[model samples]
Target: MRETREKVQLQPLDHDLAFLDITTEWDLSSSYHDWRPSIAVPATFVPATIPRVIAICNQKGGAGKTTTALELALALIARGLRVRIVDVDDQEASISVWLRYYMDDRPEELRYNLRDLYFNAKVKLSEASYPTDFENLTFIPSFPDLGEVDEKNPVGADTCLQRRLRQGADDVDVTIIDCGPRLGQLTVSALVAADDVIIPVKASSILDMKGVAALQKVVNVVKDTLNPDLRIAAAVLTDFSRSKMTRRIGGSLARAYPDAVILPARTNVKVGEAQLAQQPLRQFAPRETTTLDYDLGARVLFGLGAAA
Candidate 1:
């Protein structure tokens, strides 16, 4: 990815430069004065730690969980890090569907996937890790039938990810799990396996803010009995319009999770087009503000140097 980026003569999009200079006034003008599209960064993130597993989850549908997973994976890949994206969302909208062009080209035979990990103990994580169109970016596809785990929920469903995901993560620099919208055992399994949890909330919905409290309870429970290291590491404000509501939510989250990184991915119309085109937003609309937001997100979360 670094080589590919170097060859392309990367520079900040004109819109991104505009972001560097912005004025604002809002309902919470005094309290939210510190809000910015991108968060501050240091010279580097944590040690180039290998296998820093993260889970992108939100109970609300259309909260940008999958978008957060895919775009952040692409952004990390741009920095030359090996990343694996796991589709734990056993719904129609998993990455398997969005990036079908990249996911559908496997050899003609029975293939292993996330379903096998839940039901078939014989299936190793390596068997399910498949390649995508991008180098150094692996994918673990899931099917709708995998939802049976939620319906039937076999014994020990909660720890399947904790028991399996890390073994496969040994070779990669990061593992990102795209969780289903339901905050059931499946999503709990994701939380159990992660070092960090990124909650992507759509900025337009006040209901989105209400869901955060419910999610916070779940995170506390997961920390107590499951993964003690698990934390709400970041909050992503998706489809940010810089409205008064956006600032309100931003301030609320900052107060709620003082240590977590808060990133605002500005709205872009091309996201759906890229999904329809069967490509990542980073590749389909490299110059869009949303793409750079994801890039800034990946760098900020992983402790990479700030890019111009």
Candidate 2:
């Protein structure tokens, strides 16, 4: 029995099998002079089941950008399709942190199935993947410290996320990039990396129109130079309240972006609570209208059928 145990312990891990060991004793910082060779893994191609990549972006703040992204991801996963999220917003890191907190707090049944992919130049696609409880849901976690990367460089400076994404596409059915509320390099990079862009507009005033226009310009830039295949997949009207003005705004937007999808205007405290608790609305408030809207939005984006 001792020899058998020793043999089993000495067995090497499979080539594709890996795990994380968060050791604190090792020092990561290097002085101006001290240096050592960093570990390198040969780049391996990761084929994607679906070629579509969606970038949830809007130039305006308070557009429910993160919420929209998370909802869409959760909806797709609920449909039994594999989905992964990429956190490109360095400032908030909202989506990634939520996934971590959910994993930390929830029971196994209630836990969100997600993984994380840190945004870094040297980061391999493998380091970004982690398994979760959901069969079809995966996440690419981000860190709050990523905000520091913003201060050091411009927003779109993290351009390599596109390359990394392309390389990792084969592992999942879809990839959703949660972009920050800025048209900097991060947004630009996301646009460049994605095959489609979903613009979320919060119907407040003429400002939303202006925000959409600005986002359109960025999309054009990405199409004209960076990613010609990139196009607007859908424009979602979030926080839609029952009012004459909101109705008018929705009509105008629908007429302008004929291909855009106008989902039901349903917002609730449960949504805010879900985010606070790091849970998706579908999991936190399955019966809420918010879940229905998200499901409808996903159907429109995926062309599964008419709005739910």
Candidate 3:
């Protein structure tokens, strides 16, 4: 069978300039100043020695999980870590689309959908992964047929992703899973497979907060039963506004998950604009405030200096 292709214009980036100016051009004011200092990294902090599996998950649609996953993946790549993105979201497949936009020259033979991993975990993962234009980054594209896996409810369906990664992705420094916006078998598999989960919440809406609460319950259940090592790393606030209600919810979230990190709302419109352009925010608009927010997030997640 032939694969569907969508052509998009690719943007050229000055790699030398981007790498040199990223840290100097970063503006810290865009982050919530009140809470930024609290998570600041110490001079003696050290990143984890082994690879980590992170899942950017939220059961609510439009909660910025995909955006967070992409930005965080870029940040890790910038730090010289090998990262792989697994698109488990059968519906949107935004990450796969982003890769396709960047690499229009991708060969038909290299195009393999993540759905293949369900039937043949190890072999499909090794065969499906394609390299992006960016060094140290690779991803497995998603296909609509991935939705079919949910219906099968095959034995060990919940652990297929984890098993595949363990077998085929041992050399990867970090693997970020972009889960679909529902608590289905796929999402459950991601949660069970992940070492840590980052839940992106939209602070302006109370409904999103409810979604977070429900997801937290599922995280608790998974940790207790399926994966004892699983942890809720943080709850990131996306498209955050400084409205009164936003502040109220932010305060409530901080109080509720006092131990877990609650990242400041990253409000820059450039985030969405960059996504539409099929580019990472840092690569497309390095000096943007939202890019800095993502950098901070990546640092905090990896035990690197938050203020770096």
| Full-model lDDT for every candidate | 0.76, 0.62, 0.71
Q: Which lDDT tens digits does candidate 2 get at residues 1-308?
A: 11211110111112222211111111124442452211111122111226578899888887878888888877777665677887777655467666553344435443322112223445467555554545555666655555544455644454566777777777888889898887876677778888877777886656877888898888887788878867666666677555555555656665555544445436578877887777767677776766666665565556554322
Off by over 4 Å in 1: 1-49, 100-109
Model number with the top lDDT: 1
| Residue runs of model 2 more than 4 Å from their true location after superposition | 1-49, 101-121, 147-159, 306-308
Per-residue CA lDDT of model 1 for 243-291, tens digit only, reads 6778778768767776677777888889888878877788888878888
Residue-level lDDT for 124 in candidate 2: 63
Better of 1 and 3 by TM-score: 1
If ranked by TM-score, best first, what sequence of candidates would result?
Answer: 1, 3, 2
Task: Show how many residue pairs clash in every candidate, following the order shown.
Answer: 1, 15, 0
TM-score of every candidate: 0.86, 0.72, 0.81
Clashing pairs in 3: none
RMSD of each: 4.9, 18.6, 6.2
Candidate 3 per-residue C-alpha lDDT over 22-130 given as tens digits, one digit per residue, 9 for 90 to 100? 1211123454544222232223323344488989888888888888888888888877788899898876546777875433445765555677777754456767777
Please identify which of the two predictions, 1 or 2, would achieve the higher TM-score against the true structure: 1
